[model samples]
Target: MNFKGKSLSLKEYNDLADILQNKYGMQFLGDYEALCSNIAAGKEEEKNQAKPEPVIKQGQGDEEKAVFIRGTIRSGQLIRSEGNIVVLGDVNPGAYLEAAGSITVMGKMRGTGHAGTQGDYSTYIAAFRLEPMQLRIGDIVTRPPDGKQYKSKVPEMAFVKKGMIIVEPYLGKR
Candidate 1:
């Protein structure tokens, strides 16, 4: 916090890292694995006793890579990640998910999934259950059948074909 001042004490730096780790699942700073190893390898005490260098590096590349999400996309849940999004559990109806790349939901999907919100035409939506009220990719839009959970099967992926969205099973080729 007080980077302008003299070098930061180890306690101060470590406290800051701890705060960031607790506040956010993972700090935007460099990987914590090395730090953990340093502490576990008994070098932490030595490093802490001395003035610790500034952690200059931040998160690595692949910033646009798909984010592997592992949870149920519950109602009122809004998941917006930079790259592709993958959900391990079901996505409730009222929830919303918008990603730059493709979206794959392992569990039931009944929410709104907007792929290519950043304007990529090749983006897609894949879900264990595709029964969304609406879906959009690039400049195309599509709505599922009227009945509740009609022809939509257990595993389906929706993509634009001939300026229209076509939902297909994800089990085999094509």
Candidate 2:
């Protein structure tokens, strides 16, 4: 399907793909690079159609607030928040998430998550099933060791410890 001149969001694209796959049995054959390019083009078109507005100054209280998102984050999508972020659904591969504060995924996480984007080393990332492609906290970045796999799919949390990222099972009510 040609998406040129169309401004469909990532979720819309995912929904369309699902319908095509399930109903028509046609798989989307585009690569990640092509999908990203299409998304970028749609965003650019949206920016051109919308008028510029003055930057809104956020109060100190807003910095402590959290952003909540519902639904799966598919590939070629990016999510960012100034404060904490909580996703109610899975974060699929090729998706990116960034939060200045902490990040919590209620479902599986199989994408890139960057916490402490504003240099808050104390920020952390938590997920029901942690299988991230890459992770970052503050200025440090890490990935699973080559060929390393977790035996258990338990809920886990990641945080910076002694300048290194550490992942551990989430023990309740610590």
Candidate 3:
């Protein structure tokens, strides 16, 4: 792309191309000048479109907040929350879930989940079927045993134990 007649470097061009393709659904067709013009046109169209106002509930703060997802997390999708995350459906492979406090899945969890991402190892991950592709707690990262599919009828919880992550049966509240 040209900025006041100055051309962009290859890396900068690639980055801008990625933004255009991913954000505006524009495919690069060997015409940099046309791509830039299309981007400008898209921005103008967006400016003319009406947008809904966001809602904020009173008395709720970030530390006390938890993100709740009601459906399956598909591949290539990522969900991140600053507090906690609770998913009502399965987390499919290639999906990613990250939270600062804890992560809870009401159904199968076959994706990558990172809880306590801010280094709070006390946080845990619980799921009805804890069969994740990978898991990270605090600074520790681990993957499921090689070649073994998880087949459990009960819920399970994973937490930090002795500087490592350990999985155990999630036998409800005491």
Q: Find the candidate with the highest lDDT and give its number.
A: 3
- In model 3, how large is the Cα lDDT of residue 136? 98
Q: Per-residue lDDT of 98-173 in model 1, one digit per residue for the tens?
A: 8777788888878888887766767789988787868888667777877566645558899878888888887886
Tens digit of lDDT per residue, candidate 3, span 36-113?
A: 776778678778876733322222213455899999999999998777899999999999998887899999999999
Models 1 onward score TM values of 0.59, 0.62, 0.62
List the candidates ranked by TM-score, beginning with the highest: 3, 2, 1
Model 3: residues with Cα > 4 Å off, grouped in runs:
1-62, 172-174
> How would you encode candidate 2's per-residue C-alpha lDDT over 51-160 as one tens digit per residue?
64422223211244568999999999999887778999999999999988788999999999998887778888999999998999989999988776743468999998
Window of ten residues with lowest summed lDDT in model 1: 54-63
Candidate 2 residue 82 C-alpha distance from true site, Å: 0.3
Native RMSD of candidate 3 (Å): 17.1
Please estimate how well model 2 matches the true structure, expressed as its whole-model Cα lDDT: 0.82
